[model samples]
Target: MRSNAARNALSGCLGFALIVLAGFNAAPARAQDQLKVAIGQINNWENQAPTLGQDAGIFKRHNLVLENV
Candidate 1:
């Protein structure tokens, strides 16, 4: 036979565990797909390099979208 205190403690722990499990199961799914890129420094000659490649359709040829930021 279990004591009343032990039974109450066990029930409290089980309820908390169930609440935690329910929270984990109820996570959001639909997240945005965005890439964060950064460029340190820019050179005058190389500044338009990406633009030249883009104008020449090199990015399209390689299946890439190079956004300058």
Candidate 2:
């Protein structure tokens, strides 16, 4: 029927859209993308994790740049 054809066409369009969205979501980040984290009014063990993780090379290994402020 015409309604069945229309439904199939719509389903195909939706499937293509989902594939395009998945491709966009899977795109990799650039190497120079740095994350800036602000620690206001307090600088202690709790606030020092980002810097510590950066120093430990964990962030670099995961392609993340942590900028603590």
Candidate 3:
């Protein structure tokens, strides 16, 4: 009787895991929107941070895309 209970518990756990995995897999991929932004100054080194942020994925994390001129 105990073995039957254990088997049922295991099956239930597996079923729950499968459902969670399926939910994750069925979710749609989110496409990040690319932004076109203009910075007033390109001649100065102070403008480097925005360029670095975009290149290092920091801007994407904050949902920003910068275009400097």
Q: For this target, which candidate reaches the highest TM-score against the unseen true structure?
A: 3
Question: Candidate 2 has which clashing residue pairs, if any?
Answer: none
Mark the regions of model 2 whose C-alpha exceeds 4 Å error after superposition: 1-32
> What would the per-residue lDDT of candidate 1 be over residues 25-63, giving only the tens digit for each residue?
996854433333344465566556776776898766655
Candidate 3 residue lDDT tens string, 1-69:
479889999999999999999998896767776766676676678867778788898978876666665
- Using TM-score as the yardstick, the better of models 1 and 2 is 2
Tens digits of per-residue lDDT, candidate 2, 1-69, equal 479889999999999999999998996756656899997554578777787888899988888887777
Mind sharing the TM-score for model 2?
Answer: 0.47
What TM-score does candidate 1 reach? 0.41
Best by lDDT: 2
Off by over 4 Å in 3: 1-26, 61-69
Question: Relative to the unseen true structure, what is the C-alpha lDDT of residue 44 in candidate 1, on a scale of 0 to 100?
Answer: 60
Each model's lDDT comes to: 0.72, 0.83, 0.79
TM per prediction: 0.41, 0.47, 0.50
* lDDT, residue 30, candidate 1: 48
Displacement of the residue 41 alpha carbon in candidate 1, Å: 51
